[model samples]
Target: YRAFERKYRKNLKALYLVHPTNFIRLALQVFKPFVSAKFGRKVMYISDLSELNQHIRLDQLCIPNAVDEYDAQLLAKEKKPSAAASNAFQLNSTENGKALLETQQFGVSLAFIKENNGGEVIPPIMKTCLEYIS
Candidate 1:
């Protein structure tokens, strides 16, 4: 996967890890050090169909039944709640005063998020990207 991912890195727009398992997530973390910082950000974990829809247009997508069934099982486990937290984005405040982001394929997709007044930059070009978030 690492080699395959690197080979197609240039043309790759986005990579959605549909129905990810804990083992898969851990494997990614173990190999994260070998990958580029920017490359690591390319991975995004989508647990179910609805979450996938937010990032992609469903009409253009094709999901297998096995994937859907796996998602349903995970969803069921989530509804009942478990001691372990599900895959999610988290902000960590460290002693050094650095805010670290913890996520699976969790990186800021866009250089700029929202402005002070909840508005995105027009044209959506590289130059319009904000340099700092804080």
Candidate 2:
């Protein structure tokens, strides 16, 4: 990190960290005092892709598929309900509950997939398999 920083510090504009975990947060907090204030200011802890997209165009980056998958997982986790709410949902017998369940494929919403794919409904079989395995 030091060598890279030394070489590119002058040219670098910002260093964005997407989906920073708790360990990363703790490390940054511990090492922050050692780094220059200017360098510290340049470090941006991005919570999600949407936040990173605001600073730079995602098309320009050669992001890995795993990174995208991880970001999606993080987003899904954030949107997931509490244990009590999930139990309530499981017990629900209303048509609305069924409709809501249908809308969710894997962790991603069917509406989201349709919107991204020009109104086409894509089968989310992978999620069903994953759920079964878990």
Candidate 3:
């Protein structure tokens, strides 16, 4: 950021940061002196994914899986992961690179994935909260 601020700062218009950690916040504090008022006003800090959607849609960016992991924790804060939350769906693979099932559950539903031709059905209480699947 410091390097870019010195050279290409004028070329930039708006800047958005996602899930800024403590270290990033500290770095920005240190960098405040170097950034000019005009450019500094354009800098925006996005604390959550939904907030970022206002500026740029999720489809526009290829967000990493690690971001999702941080998201769950961010929402719950200090609460521990419940049993249902921990295993809403179990992922198995035909190959190491393969994902088992793609599910998009709206309202409420269950996900029953049978592997190796095994006759396993989901229990009545196995409702899922998954909104998207890929």
Candidate 4:
């Protein structure tokens, strides 16, 4: 961000952040003092693509298929029952829990992949990367 500001400060307009979870918002708040009000005001938190569309044309950008899928997952999760959703946050005490506490690679947690992917086997590339890193 500092480098971008240094080079493109004059031409820089709004910085739109989509799908910003609580963690992202909290981190920005923590660094609020370091960011100038002018720059901060130019930053916008867009909840989803529809909100983003109001600001700019979505067709102009090359959005990844994974992003669309993830956004759809987020929407579906929101529509689900609160009880069903809470299961993901429950404490894991099984064997998977033990592994989850240990396995992390490339900023992706084993627990997250397991929970999200319905306990399916990890992809070959991820498995290979984990093996090499370990």
Candidate 5:
């Protein structure tokens, strides 16, 4: 992990877990001292898998039947524009405009889908509150 971080030059985020039922017994028998010393207040134990699943979407393990094949294909086809070209595209066009307005609109729509699905956006009204704090 440290080697990967050095190569990438980025901090890592991860979700760590132990089986809920076995964790308590194992910690008591063998891991108590180490866990207590290492995590202290940061360690949290949740007893139910259902509760954990509420926070995490286990999409690979349980695929939704409602997602149609066409929709999946459409999503897979979408791509992000290269960083250099992204901001060069025009949003508005006049008759016989030189810019590829359709491609730009598609890129913007793809960005919205990616950002929203990846939990990147805040609602516009709530964003005003965030702006004041920052």
Candidate 6:
């Protein structure tokens, strides 16, 4: 583990423990101190591949999982469409159409969050956005 750290030092941004086996989890825990000391607070644990993908940046080479409600909320907030612009452009201009298209693509890409049946509730606009992205 130290050797791995030495080789990848500073270049490592996040540590992903994917559905780790018990032994691996234990090993990870043992190395947690070292990792934290080396990488600071960038470690994140994820149970699903999609969650890992979404949380990690695109340039990091991980394909995102379908967006969840929380993810949708963040994306919606980040890419929220301006109501005034929506009315004026309405997919008519090339740029507006492209922006709308990108938002829609991201929305649909997150649709799977609706299927996960957790007790967590989702908002209507988020659902609509997910459908659009899909």
Return the top candidate by lDDT.
2
Better of 2 and 5 by TM-score: 2
Once model 1 is optimally superposed onto the true structure by TM-score, how far is the C-alpha of residue 53 displaced, in angstroms? 0.6
Off by over 4 Å in 3: 2-9, 78-134
TM-score of each: 0.51, 0.57, 0.48, 0.56, 0.24, 0.33
Q: Write the per-residue lDDT of candidate 4 for residues 79-130, one digit (tens) a residue.
A: 7758754564444423444533434543346555676775668855677889
Write candidate 6's Cα lDDT for 69-130 as tens digits: 55565556757778986665554444323333455432332333455536457745666789
Off by over 4 Å in 4: 5-7, 81-134
Query: What number of clashing residue pairs does each candidate have, in the order they appear?
Result: 1, 0, 0, 0, 0, 5
Pairs that clash in candidate 4: none
Q: Decide which is better by TM-score, 1 or 6.
A: 1
Where does model 1 exceed 4 Å of error?
1-7, 77-134
- Candidate 5 per-residue lDDT, tens place, 1-134, comes to 22455544233233324234575656654855654343334345543344445756655455344434543554455556666565544333422445344654433444444556547565444577789999
| Model 4: residue 59 alpha-carbon error in angstroms | 0.2
Q: Which of the numbered candidates is closest to the native, going by highest TM-score? A: 2
Q: Report clash pairs, candidate 1.
A: 43-105
Q: Which of the two candidates, 2 or 6, achieves a greater TM-score against the reference?
A: 2
TM-score-based ranking, best first? 2, 4, 1, 3, 6, 5
- Model 4 quality (TM-score): 0.56
Better of 2 and 4 by lDDT: 2
Instruction: Show model 5 residue runs off by greater than 4 Å.
Output: 1-19, 22-30, 35-43, 60-134
User: What overall lDDT goes with each candidate model?
Assistant: 0.65, 0.77, 0.65, 0.76, 0.47, 0.58
